[model samples]
Target: MRDEKWTARIEAGVEGLTKAEWAPDSRNILCFSEWGLRVTIWSLSTGTATYIQFPKHPDRGYAFRKDGRYFVLAERYKSKDMMGVYDCPSGYKLIRHFALPTTSLASISLSPTGNHVAAWEAASEFKVVIMNLTGQHIATFIPTDDPLLGVRHILWHPSGTYLLVGGWDSKLYILSSLEWKVVATIQLASRLPSSTACCTIHSS
Candidate 1:
């Protein structure tokens, strides 16, 4: 019964899977809920799953390395922002933990090269913090002073030389990776409070 037989099944214990992302190697699955309080990763080869819980989070603040060797997250500790990097396969060891200056940090984006991570405020105009995987703070890009300046998304260019930061201000700031300066700004008609492929464009 080649056509009728079940090929495989995964018993992910997550009750409500709000979002799921596969590791670059396709050997692991990461699932999150709408609440953003917990995440579970299942190892396909080992048939085991591991979960990480958070005290609070404004958005899904985690990303897997391109090689799937480790994962990084914006974790909260005692009402403070902290970055945590965990090892793969086992997923229990906390290899690194770095304290961040702002508690409102959310929406994490690891650079394409997996060297730096960019995290921004979820509902405020706090500084966009950029740091390396070793927990060293590289730089911080300030948000607009306008009241409408809420960070919506932080995306690193494919070349990892610029960061495209957009938000409720209906504008995008292209920050040069070399100096972390705003190289250019693109204004849109509507509030850019979400990530979309159409809005992800390279700077000239």
Candidate 2:
């Protein structure tokens, strides 16, 4: 008794939706549910959905790559934090799982070139971690304390040469990817609110 004209809908007897997005390729729809414990990739042409499982619940720090080839998720397993890269074409199969040094489980971002990844730590204020796809720790940046506390967000430059880290401290930290160090810091007149942040990029 259902109409075929409807685009698509999740089948009954499943968990509710947490988040959804269209794959960059536009041919498929990616859905996350159970707080990242379950993923379903729905095909528009074939009208079928494939389910994928995660080892742990991915709270919020997760995003698919630009090319739709992969996705990065900061997952919580056994009370520990982990970073996972899953292959997009293979029903979201796990490709790599990197154990994070901290337990913040904050936001994560991938470099434009797909070579590096960065994560913000909330448990420890003003700490950012940089790493590669091979589970090797590249560098950790812990800047001087300010009124702004934990890192709120992380963004990578299009050139993949630098990163921008923002925090509650009312400042932005520009980090060099190559040198793995803070090259400059921009301070504001006021402390950034705990729930608010700023991010910008300009090439000179």
User: After aligning candidate 1 to the native by TM-score, how far in Å is the CA of 76 from where it should be?
Assistant: 1.9
- Per lDDT, the best of the predicted structures is 1
Regions more than 4 Å wrong, model 1:
1-17, 33-37, 55-59, 89-92, 143-147, 190-204
Can you list the residue pairs that collide in candidate 2? 148-168, 148-169
Query: What would the per-residue lDDT of candidate 1 be over residues 1-204, giving only the tens digit for each residue?
Result: 356643446554546666677777777777675565677777777777787776245346777788777788877777788888988755546789888767677568899888999887767564688889898888988854564657877788888999998877777889998998899998886645556435666799
Q: Candidate 2, residues 1-204: lDDT per residue as tens digits?
A: 976665556552467676677877787887778645676778787788776566344346767777779877777766787878888787667889879877755677888988887877774566777878777898988885644478867888899998998777768889888788889999866746655658545699
Cα error, candidate 1, residue 177 (Å): 0.8
Q: Evaluate model 2: give its lDDT.
A: 0.75
User: Can you tell me which runs of candidate 2 are displaced by over 4 Å?
Assistant: 1-6, 12-14, 45-48, 54-59, 146-148, 191-204
Model 2: lDDT of residue 45:
72
Residue 200 of model 2, lDDT score: 48
Give the TM-score of each candidate: 0.76, 0.78
Q: Which RMSD values do the candidates have, in order?
A: 7.2, 7.8
